[model samples]
Target: MAKVIVYPPTSMILYDLVERMGHKALVVSEAVRNLVTASGIESPPLNVTPEEPKKGLRYAAVDVPSGVRGRMALIGPIIEEAEAAIIVEDPGWLTGCSGCSRTNELVRLLIRTKGIPVLDLSYPTNDDEAKVFVQKIRTFLEGLK
Candidate 1:
Protein backbone atom coordinates (compact mmCIF):
# COMPACT_ATOMS: atom_id res chain seq x y z
CA MET A 1 0.00 0.00 0.00
CA ALA A 2 1.29 3.43 -0.95
CA LYS A 3 1.10 6.22 1.61
CA VAL A 4 -0.30 9.32 -0.04
CA ILE A 5 -0.31 12.85 1.26
CA VAL A 6 -2.92 15.13 -0.25
CA TYR A 7 -2.80 18.90 0.05
CA PRO A 8 -5.71 21.28 0.17
CA PRO A 9 -8.35 23.10 -1.89
CA THR A 10 -9.61 19.81 -3.25
CA SER A 11 -7.94 17.56 -0.73
CA MET A 12 -11.11 15.68 -0.08
CA ILE A 13 -11.66 15.14 -3.77
CA LEU A 14 -8.23 13.65 -4.21
CA TYR A 15 -8.68 11.55 -1.11
CA ASP A 16 -11.98 10.19 -2.32
CA LEU A 17 -10.54 9.53 -5.73
CA VAL A 18 -7.56 7.65 -4.34
CA GLU A 19 -9.72 5.65 -2.02
CA ARG A 20 -12.03 4.80 -4.89
CA MET A 21 -9.02 3.56 -6.77
CA GLY A 22 -8.37 1.03 -3.97
CA HIS A 23 -5.41 2.62 -2.27
CA LYS A 24 -4.71 4.06 1.14
CA ALA A 25 -4.93 7.85 1.08
CA LEU A 26 -3.67 10.01 3.88
CA VAL A 27 -4.52 13.68 3.78
CA VAL A 28 -2.01 16.20 5.12
CA SER A 29 -2.91 19.70 6.20
CA GLU A 30 -1.41 22.54 8.18
CA ALA A 31 -2.85 23.84 11.45
CA VAL A 32 -6.30 22.77 10.35
CA ARG A 33 -6.66 19.91 12.76
CA ASN A 34 -10.22 20.74 13.66
CA LEU A 35 -11.27 21.25 10.08
CA VAL A 36 -9.54 18.07 9.02
CA THR A 37 -11.09 16.19 11.88
CA ALA A 38 -14.48 17.51 10.90
CA SER A 39 -13.98 16.34 7.37
CA GLY A 40 -13.82 12.77 8.72
CA ILE A 41 -10.73 12.02 6.71
CA GLU A 42 -7.56 10.53 8.12
CA SER A 43 -5.26 13.56 8.14
CA PRO A 44 -2.23 14.78 10.01
CA PRO A 45 -1.14 18.36 10.52
CA LEU A 46 2.15 19.39 8.94
CA ASN A 47 4.84 19.43 11.58
CA VAL A 48 8.47 19.22 10.59
CA THR A 49 9.95 16.65 12.85
CA PRO A 50 13.26 14.87 12.80
CA GLU A 51 12.04 11.35 12.14
CA GLU A 52 12.71 10.72 8.45
CA PRO A 53 9.55 12.63 7.41
CA LYS A 54 7.65 9.43 6.86
CA LYS A 55 9.03 7.22 4.14
CA GLY A 56 7.27 5.80 1.09
CA LEU A 57 5.28 8.99 0.82
CA ARG A 58 3.39 9.96 -2.31
CA TYR A 59 1.69 13.33 -2.76
CA ALA A 60 -1.13 14.84 -4.75
CA ALA A 61 -2.04 18.50 -4.69
CA VAL A 62 -5.51 19.82 -5.25
CA ASP A 63 -4.29 22.33 -7.74
CA VAL A 64 -1.02 23.06 -9.44
CA PRO A 65 0.41 23.75 -6.04
CA SER A 66 -0.80 22.99 -2.54
CA GLY A 67 -1.22 25.16 0.53
CA VAL A 68 -1.69 28.88 0.99
CA ARG A 69 0.97 31.14 -0.52
CA GLY A 70 2.12 28.01 -2.40
CA ARG A 71 4.27 27.20 0.59
CA MET A 72 4.79 23.48 0.50
CA ALA A 73 6.08 22.52 3.89
CA LEU A 74 6.49 18.84 3.10
CA ILE A 75 8.22 18.82 -0.25
CA GLY A 76 11.84 18.69 0.80
CA PRO A 77 12.09 15.18 2.17
CA ILE A 78 9.58 13.80 -0.26
CA ILE A 79 11.63 15.11 -3.11
CA GLU A 80 14.76 13.60 -1.68
CA GLU A 81 13.00 10.29 -1.42
CA ALA A 82 11.97 10.56 -5.05
CA GLU A 83 8.30 10.21 -4.31
CA ALA A 84 5.71 10.39 -7.01
CA ALA A 85 3.86 13.71 -7.30
CA ILE A 86 0.54 14.15 -9.00
CA ILE A 87 -0.28 17.66 -10.13
CA VAL A 88 -3.87 18.61 -10.82
CA GLU A 89 -4.61 21.46 -13.20
CA ASP A 90 -6.36 24.60 -12.09
CA PRO A 91 -5.27 27.43 -14.35
CA GLY A 92 -7.57 29.95 -12.73
CA TRP A 93 -6.22 29.28 -9.27
CA LEU A 94 -2.64 29.26 -10.47
CA THR A 95 -3.10 32.59 -12.23
CA GLY A 96 -4.88 34.09 -9.25
CA CYS A 97 -1.84 33.70 -7.01
CA SER A 98 1.75 34.38 -7.88
CA GLY A 99 2.88 32.27 -4.96
CA CYS A 100 1.01 29.33 -6.42
CA SER A 101 2.74 29.78 -9.76
CA ARG A 102 6.15 29.95 -8.13
CA THR A 103 5.45 26.92 -6.06
CA ASN A 104 4.33 25.07 -9.13
CA GLU A 105 7.53 25.98 -10.89
CA LEU A 106 9.50 24.65 -7.97
CA VAL A 107 7.57 21.43 -8.04
CA ARG A 108 8.19 21.02 -11.73
CA LEU A 109 11.85 21.66 -11.27
CA LEU A 110 12.06 19.10 -8.51
CA ILE A 111 10.24 16.53 -10.55
CA ARG A 112 12.38 17.06 -13.61
CA THR A 113 15.74 17.30 -11.87
CA LYS A 114 15.18 14.51 -9.40
CA GLY A 115 13.58 12.18 -11.93
CA ILE A 116 10.47 11.71 -9.82
CA PRO A 117 7.56 10.27 -11.69
CA VAL A 118 5.01 13.04 -12.25
CA LEU A 119 1.46 12.72 -13.46
CA ASP A 120 -0.27 15.78 -14.83
CA LEU A 121 -4.00 15.38 -14.51
CA SER A 122 -4.83 18.70 -16.06
CA TYR A 123 -7.63 17.92 -18.47
CA PRO A 124 -10.48 16.66 -16.33
CA THR A 125 -12.95 19.50 -15.96
CA ASN A 126 -16.12 17.51 -15.36
CA ASP A 127 -17.30 14.30 -13.74
CA ASP A 128 -16.38 12.28 -16.79
CA GLU A 129 -13.02 13.90 -16.99
CA ALA A 130 -12.49 13.36 -13.29
CA LYS A 131 -13.12 9.67 -13.79
CA VAL A 132 -10.50 9.59 -16.48
CA PHE A 133 -8.12 11.43 -14.22
CA VAL A 134 -8.66 8.85 -11.54
CA GLN A 135 -7.97 6.09 -13.99
CA LYS A 136 -4.83 7.81 -15.14
CA ILE A 137 -3.67 8.25 -11.58
CA ARG A 138 -4.27 4.58 -10.86
CA THR A 139 -2.30 3.67 -13.89
CA PHE A 140 0.56 5.85 -12.78
CA LEU A 141 0.48 4.31 -9.34
CA GLU A 142 0.54 0.87 -10.82
CA GLY A 143 3.54 1.78 -12.88
CA LEU A 144 5.33 2.76 -9.72
CA LYS A 145 5.01 -0.84 -8.66
Candidate 2:
Protein backbone atom coordinates (compact mmCIF):
# COMPACT_ATOMS: atom_id res chain seq x y z
CA MET A 1 0.00 0.00 0.00
CA ALA A 2 1.13 3.54 -0.70
CA LYS A 3 2.06 5.88 2.10
CA VAL A 4 -0.02 8.99 1.52
CA ILE A 5 0.77 12.18 3.39
CA VAL A 6 -2.28 14.33 3.89
CA TYR A 7 -1.74 18.06 4.02
CA PRO A 8 -2.79 19.84 7.20
CA PRO A 9 -1.60 16.56 8.73
CA THR A 10 -4.45 16.65 11.21
CA SER A 11 -7.47 16.24 8.98
CA MET A 12 -9.20 13.01 9.93
CA ILE A 13 -11.38 13.12 6.83
CA LEU A 14 -8.34 12.85 4.62
CA TYR A 15 -6.84 10.29 6.94
CA ASP A 16 -9.95 8.15 6.81
CA LEU A 17 -10.25 8.43 3.06
CA VAL A 18 -6.65 7.36 2.57
CA GLU A 19 -7.06 4.45 4.92
CA ARG A 20 -10.35 3.51 3.33
CA MET A 21 -8.65 3.33 -0.04
CA GLY A 22 -6.19 0.76 1.41
CA HIS A 23 -3.23 3.10 1.80
CA LYS A 24 -1.42 4.25 4.87
CA ALA A 25 -2.27 7.82 5.90
CA LEU A 26 0.57 9.75 7.44
CA VAL A 27 -0.84 12.28 9.88
CA VAL A 28 0.34 14.32 12.88
CA SER A 29 -1.51 12.15 15.34
CA GLU A 30 0.97 9.36 14.70
CA ALA A 31 3.84 11.59 15.78
CA VAL A 32 1.92 12.77 18.80
CA ARG A 33 1.25 9.18 19.62
CA ASN A 34 4.94 8.39 19.64
CA LEU A 35 5.74 11.39 21.80
CA VAL A 36 3.14 10.59 24.41
CA THR A 37 3.59 6.86 24.50
CA ALA A 38 7.35 6.73 24.64
CA SER A 39 8.87 5.33 27.84
CA GLY A 40 11.42 8.14 28.35
CA ILE A 41 8.86 10.91 28.56
CA GLU A 42 9.15 12.61 31.93
CA SER A 43 5.98 14.61 32.32
CA PRO A 44 2.83 15.77 30.64
CA PRO A 45 3.86 19.43 30.84
CA LEU A 46 5.80 19.37 27.56
CA ASN A 47 4.89 17.54 24.38
CA VAL A 48 8.34 17.61 22.81
CA THR A 49 11.48 15.69 23.52
CA PRO A 50 14.93 17.35 23.64
CA GLU A 51 15.91 15.54 20.44
CA GLU A 52 12.99 16.95 18.46
CA PRO A 53 14.49 20.42 18.12
CA LYS A 54 17.78 18.95 17.06
CA LYS A 55 16.12 16.63 14.54
CA GLY A 56 14.19 19.59 13.15
CA LEU A 57 17.44 21.28 12.17
CA ARG A 58 17.80 18.79 9.34
CA TYR A 59 14.72 20.33 7.71
CA ALA A 60 14.98 23.91 9.04
CA ALA A 61 17.88 26.07 10.15
CA VAL A 62 18.67 27.05 13.73
CA ASP A 63 17.69 30.67 13.10
CA VAL A 64 14.15 29.69 12.18
CA PRO A 65 11.39 29.94 14.76
CA SER A 66 11.37 27.02 17.16
CA GLY A 67 7.72 26.36 16.45
CA VAL A 68 8.47 25.78 12.80
CA ARG A 69 11.47 23.69 13.66
CA GLY A 70 9.52 21.57 16.10
CA ARG A 71 6.73 21.00 13.65
CA MET A 72 9.08 20.21 10.81
CA ALA A 73 10.95 17.75 12.97
CA LEU A 74 7.82 15.78 13.56
CA ILE A 75 6.56 16.08 10.00
CA GLY A 76 9.72 16.06 7.91
CA PRO A 77 10.48 12.43 8.44
CA ILE A 78 6.93 11.55 7.60
CA ILE A 79 7.25 13.44 4.35
CA GLU A 80 10.41 11.57 3.51
CA GLU A 81 8.56 8.29 3.86
CA ALA A 82 5.56 9.36 1.81
CA GLU A 83 5.00 7.64 -1.51
CA ALA A 84 2.31 10.10 -2.57
CA ALA A 85 0.33 12.99 -1.16
CA ILE A 86 -3.11 14.54 -1.04
CA ILE A 87 -3.27 18.24 -0.28
CA VAL A 88 -6.50 20.08 0.48
CA GLU A 89 -5.76 23.77 0.20
CA ASP A 90 -7.55 26.63 1.94
CA PRO A 91 -9.60 24.28 4.02
CA GLY A 92 -11.84 25.89 6.62
CA TRP A 93 -10.12 26.71 9.90
CA LEU A 94 -11.83 23.84 11.64
CA THR A 95 -10.67 21.39 9.00
CA GLY A 96 -7.09 22.36 8.24
CA CYS A 97 -5.50 24.51 10.90
CA SER A 98 -2.03 23.12 11.54
CA GLY A 99 -1.53 26.30 13.67
CA CYS A 100 1.56 27.53 11.81
CA SER A 101 1.52 28.93 8.32
CA ARG A 102 5.27 28.64 7.88
CA THR A 103 5.15 24.99 8.78
CA ASN A 104 2.27 24.40 6.41
CA GLU A 105 4.10 26.08 3.53
CA LEU A 106 7.29 24.20 4.27
CA VAL A 107 5.46 20.91 4.51
CA ARG A 108 3.84 21.50 1.12
CA LEU A 109 7.17 22.46 -0.36
CA LEU A 110 8.77 19.32 0.99
CA ILE A 111 6.01 17.11 -0.33
CA ARG A 112 6.02 18.70 -3.78
CA THR A 113 9.78 18.34 -4.05
CA LYS A 114 9.70 14.71 -3.00
CA GLY A 115 8.98 13.69 -6.64
CA ILE A 116 5.82 11.83 -5.74
CA PRO A 117 2.41 12.02 -7.33
CA VAL A 118 0.43 14.76 -5.58
CA LEU A 119 -3.26 15.50 -5.83
CA ASP A 120 -4.13 19.05 -4.89
CA LEU A 121 -7.69 19.97 -4.09
CA SER A 122 -9.52 23.03 -2.87
CA TYR A 123 -11.90 22.98 0.05
CA PRO A 124 -15.47 22.39 -1.02
CA THR A 125 -18.07 25.00 -0.16
CA ASN A 126 -21.26 23.23 -1.25
CA ASP A 127 -22.80 19.80 -1.64
CA ASP A 128 -21.93 19.49 -5.32
CA GLU A 129 -18.40 20.66 -4.72
CA ALA A 130 -18.08 18.25 -1.83
CA LYS A 131 -19.15 15.34 -4.00
CA VAL A 132 -16.64 16.30 -6.65
CA PHE A 133 -13.95 16.68 -4.04
CA VAL A 134 -14.50 13.16 -2.75
CA GLN A 135 -14.59 11.75 -6.27
CA LYS A 136 -11.33 13.43 -7.19
CA ILE A 137 -9.63 12.17 -4.09
CA ARG A 138 -10.97 8.68 -4.62
CA THR A 139 -9.86 8.64 -8.21
CA PHE A 140 -6.40 9.90 -7.42
CA LEU A 141 -5.92 7.42 -4.61
CA GLU A 142 -7.21 4.49 -6.61
CA GLY A 143 -4.83 5.36 -9.39
CA LEU A 144 -1.87 4.79 -7.09
CA LYS A 145 -0.20 1.40 -7.45
Residues 53-101 of candidate 1: C-alpha lDDT, one tens digit per residue: 2321233444433342224444433345444556666634431222455
- Model 2 has how many clashing residue pairs? 0
Instruction: Give all candidates' CA lDDT scores.
Output: 0.49, 0.90
User: After superposition, which runs of candidate 2 have C-alpha atoms over 4 Å from their true positions?
Assistant: 43-46
Query: What TM-score, to 2 decimals, does candidate 1 have?
Result: 0.51
Q: What TM-scores do the predictions have?
A: 0.51, 0.95
Report the Cα lDDT for residue 2, model 2.
Answer: 97
lDDT by residue (1-145, candidate 2, tens digit) is 8999999898888999999999999998898888888887775644686677788999999998888888888899899999999999998777756789999999999999999999999999999999999999999999999
- lDDT measured at residue 83 in model 1 versus the true structure, 0 to 100: 49
